[model samples]
Each structure stands twice: as C-alpha cells, then as structure tokens.
Target chain A: MTAVATACPPAVRQGGGPVPVVSEGPALLAGIAQGPGLAAHLNRLGPAPRPSLGALVDMARDVDLRGRGGAGFPFATKLSAAARRRAVVVVNASEGEPGSHKDAALISCAPHVVLDGAAAVARALRTQEVHIVVSSEHPSLRRVVEKALRERVTAGECLDLRLHDAAPRFVAGQAQAVLQLLAGRENLPVTAWQPEAVSGHRGRPTLLSNAETFAQIGHLVRVGSAGYAAHGTAGEPGTTLVTLRGDGWAPEVREVAHGTPLADLLDEAETSRPLLLGGYHGTWLRPAQLRGMTVSRSAIAAAGATLGAGVMLPLAQGRCPLVRTAELVEYLAGQSARRCGPCLNGLPAMAEAVRALVHGEGSVRRVEELCGLVVRRGACAHPDGTARLVASMMQRFPAEVQAHSVGTCRRGREVSG
Target chain B: MSEHQLRVDWPACKGHGLCAELLPEVISLDEWGYPIVHEPVKGEVLAMARRAVKACPTLALRLTLPA
Candidate 1:
C-alpha cells in the first residue's frame, strides 16, 4: 500500500560518493576469444587445447575461479566430478533475484562469450549436449543466445546446444529444480535421495552453473589465470558484476575487481549511509566498517556476510531498515517455489512476524527465534538467505524495531534515514 | 528414507486460513492470514496433510517429498 520513492539515485553527486563500477568506466565487454592472447586460447581459430580432462582441471586451478553464482562453489571441483559419459552442461540464466539483472545484461550484451564457455565445457567433457535455460520473460535474449549458438554450430562447433525456457518461478532457477525441468519432469524441486548434481537430468551427471560463471570461464580461458588474476585478489581472481540500487543511488550494473574495497565502491556510488552488502539474502554492515573492506567472498565471509550475487544497496540514515527488511522479506517469500518445508512454511511465518513488528503488533524476540529456526531447513538457500537478510536487518536496525514495538514509529509517513 | 514436506504457490496464495483450520497441529495461521505449516507430515500424516490440502479454499497447499 506504500509507494515509496523508487527513483534511481543521482548519476554523480558532487562530493557524495565514489562512482559505481557499472558507471566508473565503459564495460570492457569481452566476448569469447577465438584466438589466443593468454591462457590456452583454443577455439576454431585458436589452437584448440586438445580436450584433456586434466588440462581443463589444471586451467580452472590456475585461475582459481569459483562459481560466479551465489554459492561460490569451486568450478574446478565441480568439473572434476562431472566427467561421466552422459555428462551435461547447463547454462542457468533464470536470474530471478529482484533488483538483480547482471546475468541478463551479460547474455544480452555478450551472448557469444557465454556460448563459448558452454561450448568449451561441452568440448572439455566430450559431452554431446549443452542446455541454456533462460527465463520466459527474456524471450528476445534467449533468442539471441540461441542464434549465437547456431552461428557457432555453422562454424564447426560440434555440440548440441539446446535452449530451454525455464518456468517463471523464483525457485525454478534452483539447480535441482532446473534439472527437473530439463529432464522433462515436473518443474519443481527434485525428491531424489541423492544429490542432484551427481544424479540429475535423467540419471546423468550434470554440471549446472550461472550464466556469469560460464562467461567467466570463457574469459579465464582467453585471459589465462595469471592475466585474470592480475586485477583480482590472490584467493578469488577476476572482475565481478554487481547490481547497485537504492535511494540516492543509481540502479546500474558495475564490474569491480574481486578485491575492490567496499568503501571505495560505496564512495563511488555516492551513498551517504550504512550499506547492505550482498542481495536480499546478504548482510548489513556499518559504513565505517566498510573502509578497507574487500569485496571477495572470502573477505565478505570473514566479515560475517557473503556477497550474494553482488547486490549492494545503501540505505541512507532515513530509510527505515526495519520496514525495508519487512518489504524485502515479503517479496522473497512471494518468490518461493514452495516445494520445500522450511521455505514454504518458515518464510511466510517469518514474513508475517516481521510485518507485525513493522506494523507494531509483534515482539523482536519472537522474530529472532523464528529466524534461528528458518536458516538451515530448506532444500535450497531461499529460506536460509531470507532468514539471514531479515535477521541482519533486525540486528542492524534495533532502534527501528524497538520503535515499532513501542507503537511510536509512523510507518505511513514518507520516512528516510 | 522419504521425508514429508509442505508446498505452496506463493503468488497464488491469498493468505487464506483454511489450511490451518484443517490441520491445526502442523499449520498455524499468521497475522497476515497465511498458514505456517511448520512441520510437514510424511508417510501416515501425509494423508491428513492431503486432506488439509484439499480443504484449502485458495487451493495453495500441497504435500510434497523433498528433493
């Protein structure tokens, strides 16, 4: 019922903040390299690295690349277990996270790069099949990627690159659910006793990754580990794309080096308050603590948070974190596929609790207990992430929650921090 | 080992309290009129869960197995 200001923040505020990565410079926008510049530059035009399983593993190791997806699973580790004969490669473009569009932007602006990565993985695994699952909302983008795959096929890339339209649900993008859909099963989470990665997609070993991860692989292949490592930190090398949005913040994609300090990024974005790092599933950190804070997963983890798909939103002193958290929780709860126990049950429970607190009807202690219960009981990370997001907000905005509890907070008024 | 679970269609759910009314032990009605089915009944209780599912006026509740 509230129509708060959703306008993007200023492009450049005089003495306000540092420029966002998306706007700091022109997007380098590198496509899949056909020839060699660094790494094992092997494509049609480039000397094809004779598809050795060990070589592919070594290549991934050299770059120290991890899944660009939210989980940050190791790419080399995922590839090592996926050498089965019926191995399949899945390019996940479902990208259902709200206020997050980096994957779509990557696919739309540079489809070939993602295709090259998919093709390389298929070639590396000696598999004959590759599938790209995109959201139905982005039909044109899926078309462009499919066309790029066809063009590559004509150029002698001998692999079956299939395009699949994912069901328009948030959890449909989940690894297991996506696999179920790909296998022509119900478009819901699997009920398998075994892990989906090892026994997925018609009882075959499937390698599913975000669209950005595959493109990063293609980039790593061409740039070489050392070259890719040049800009990022020692642990996680390469640039990461982040979606920055909020009041007094322009909504745009930004490419920051893996170890870019959080303070610098916020300064560039011209945010004038404490920031919410990661996505709705991420954490809230003091702005002063952001000083000299690195943006890598390890660093974020060390700081008691995870840079989930690189969604950074800065809440100035006025925007009520309690209200914002409640709104976000409601949105996330609305997006659940409702296939699991905790997510289907706990999220709505938690959302209601938070809503009651925001509307001055509940206690924070009850909300905390609910948060503790919901974190680890889901089939996917939705419940856990939602819990973490809401829990962090509750911790960070105790004052707001207290005010709401005391029935003094005027939630109807247009309030900003 | 089969596990019992609750499933919901978030967009389709209008926060009706019917599911909680049908199965009070597992599902609780929240302030927003949404049912919070905390514990999903598997095996024997699944029948009761299914009955509750059938009783949902909004048709939002379902019994499911874990993935």
Candidate 2:
C-alpha cells in the first residue's frame, strides 16, 4: 500500500521504416499485399460466428496455440482459467518492445483481424466488454482501432469494444501493468496474489492477450485447428508475424509459417555475424547455433534462445556487438519503472559497467557479477531480461571482449588507448 | 506443517532495512539498503523471521508458505 513517486521515462520511438507484412500462408495477413481494409478483412476472412467457450478452448488446445506475446503461454490454459467467472477480454496492443512492431502492424494494416479476434474471445467468454489497450504515443493506431470498432458495429457485431491509451513505457505492456491502467491506477506492475485470469479488472476473471494473439484467434476460429496447423511445425502451429531487422533498413514486420528456417528471413551474406533473436531483451545466436534452427518456439528453444515477440536483428558486419549490446542495456535501464530496488540500482550499475567494458575501462568479471545480482531480483522481468541480453553478449563475443579490454575494438578502432 | 518463506512486496518496500537487522541469517541488505532475502525460511529462524515481518515499518515483508 505504498505509493512511490516515480516519473515515467520518455518513450523511445521504435525505428525501422514501415514494416510490411510478408506471409507465406494465407491467414492473419491474407490481403495485406492488396492493401487490406475492413472490406478486405471481411472478404478474406468472413464474419466470425460465436462459438461455445468449450469449443474455443478445444481449438486453442488442439492447435497448441501459444500466445504471440513473448512468454508464449498457451492460450487454452489462460482461457480455461477464466471460464469459471464473468470475464473481460483485453487486447494488449501496447507494442512497447523497441524492435517489435507486429502488434501495431496488425492494428494498422488489418484492424478487423484484431477486432474480430477480440470480439470472438468476448463472445466465447460470454462477456460483452473487450478492451484494446494501445500506447498513447501512437495516435494513428488509436484512430485505426476506433474506426475498426465502429466498422464492426456497423457490420452488426454486438460486442462492446473500447480503446484504452497506455503511457508509452516498456513494462507498461506487461499483463499486470495493463490491468493497473484499466483499474484507473498508475500503470505500474504489482506482484498479484492471484493470477489475472482468476481475479482481474475489478476482481472479475480477465483474459488479456497480445494483439497478434487475438488476430490468431480470429484466424483459428475462421479456420479450424487442422487448417491452422497445416503449415507450422508439430509443436508450434500457424503462421506468426515477425519484426525482422538488420537487412539494411528499418525492421520489416513479416508473416512467416512456423517452421520457416532462420536462414530464410536473414541476409545470407551476414549469416556469419551474430543474430539477435527476439527483441532487445532476447538472446543472441551465433552463426553456428543458427544451423538447423527453424522459427518455431520448440526449435528456437532447443537452440537455447526464444523467439521473443518474434523479433530478429542480424548484427551488421563491421559494427561491434558488445557496443550495440551496451547501448541497448543503457536504454533498458532507463526504461525501468523505478519502483523496485534492483531495477533502480542494479540496472544502472550494470549498464555503467558494460559501458566501461566497451570503452576498455571495466572488467568482464565485474559485468558478469553485476548481471548475476540483477537477475530475478526485480518486481518485473525487466532486470532479468537485461541480464540475459548482457550475459548472452558476454558468451557470444569472447573475442570482442578480449579485444575491447586491451583498448582496441573489433571495429578496428582504438576506443580507449 | 508447510515451511514458511520470506517475501517482499518490492514496490511497498522503501528500504527500511529492519528485516535485515532482525533476521540477519535469512535477510541481508543490498547496496541500496533493500533486503535480498534468502528464501525458504529454516525451521530454526521461522520465529525470528516472523518477528522481522512484524517489525517491518512499511509492512512490505511477509512470511508465507508456498502455494
């Protein structure tokens, strides 16, 4: 019951030119190439029929549909957890991850798909209210969502859809943080005694999922589990949207089937360089680790990395990976909610240590020690994620670390000496 | 009987550091004066941990069993 006075860090606008939807499969982004509108959405994927709660759960379970959000929790498990009580469907469109834009892309290019998914979830849970939470920084996305909701109403959908504007912060998109915003409280995360699915949004059962997850649900309902599972691997089914970076321009949001090879999305010439799978908080994959790795969750997990928010940034040649990692760590440290001690203290300390290492003024052992202290010590996963990024950089770039320590850098520059 | 564990509601904790002082074995203060709990309270220290929980100024510290 303590109120800590903390200022919201200014939102870092995601760079990368307009992300285009490139899909191998015909679901989710079916008519994106032809410029999808409400009409196009309706024509490509017809109006969704209200299915029973049991049926929706069965479909999710049958396809093993995991949330498109970073954690990849199964959708069926979350749905069944909320089935016992009056529930509210929350569409988490707050795309705050720096290199992730699939949610915004979905809302902008195919708002109907997202709306249809939200409405479908509401109908399944027998709740009339569906709240789509987007960042206040993106006014255009808000307009698109509002217009799409109106379009759905005009088309005779009876679900009550609302748009909520969240302050643009990294952790603001976390489940608890979003729920706090809906509760008219400060948009900060709290360690809930009960899961949100059990008691949330005014103590009622709430099913909150990523925007792409809802669109996938809309896709799932339109096409049965068998059809949705047609393209992806056995473990992870359906086509997923990915924000692909480091191909010479801003990251492009592309839709690829689950089993697509990592090589397919990346530049073949740059395969020798380290590939950053997931966004800033995700792990780095060496070229050797990329072999035989597909885009599916199981495959990526087997490769010791996660397809976190499905972001891939191939580090450009001639750029120092450790320097890039230090820069991102600094950004993540600044984005902390500043409520927790580890995040407030540990992150800045670790960021400074990494910066010193980059400039040949710090020790690798000190950076590692700081990372160990920061992991699992914060209220949210922000500290843990930052540690993961730093740890992975240390593991993957030993040569670079040795070079940087001696006052030289991989980019062939005397950064310190 | 289920074993008691020490937990901190981090947002509520303003680094009062009473828990570390009262239950030195189970809790230690970080560089910023916040408690870094060694979780899963041992049977011998459960009483002192309870005292620490009661002694917290902000009531940010709690003793609970695993759910």
| C-alpha lDDT values of all predictions | 0.69, 0.81
Candidate 2 per-residue lDDT, tens place, A1-417, comes to: 012111111122334234343342357766665443578676766677668889999999999888888998999999999876679999998977867777877777677777777887888888998888998756666776777788778888788787898888889998889999998999888767678899989999999999999999888888889998986877777899888772235556677889988777776765778888888899998889987778888788887889989988888777788888988899999999999887898899999999999988899998988888877776678899999999999998898899988889877766853
- Give all candidate RMSDs, comma-separated: 8.2, 6.4
Docking class of 1: incorrect
Backbone clash tally (model 2): 2
Count of clashing pairs, candidate 1: 14
User: Global lDDT for candidate 1?
Assistant: 0.69
Q: After superposition, which runs of candidate 1 have C-alpha atoms over 4 Å from their true positions?
A: A1-28, A31-51, A246-249, A268-270, A409-417, B1-67
DockQ leader: 2
Q: How far is A243's C-alpha from truth in model 2 (Å)?
A: 0.1
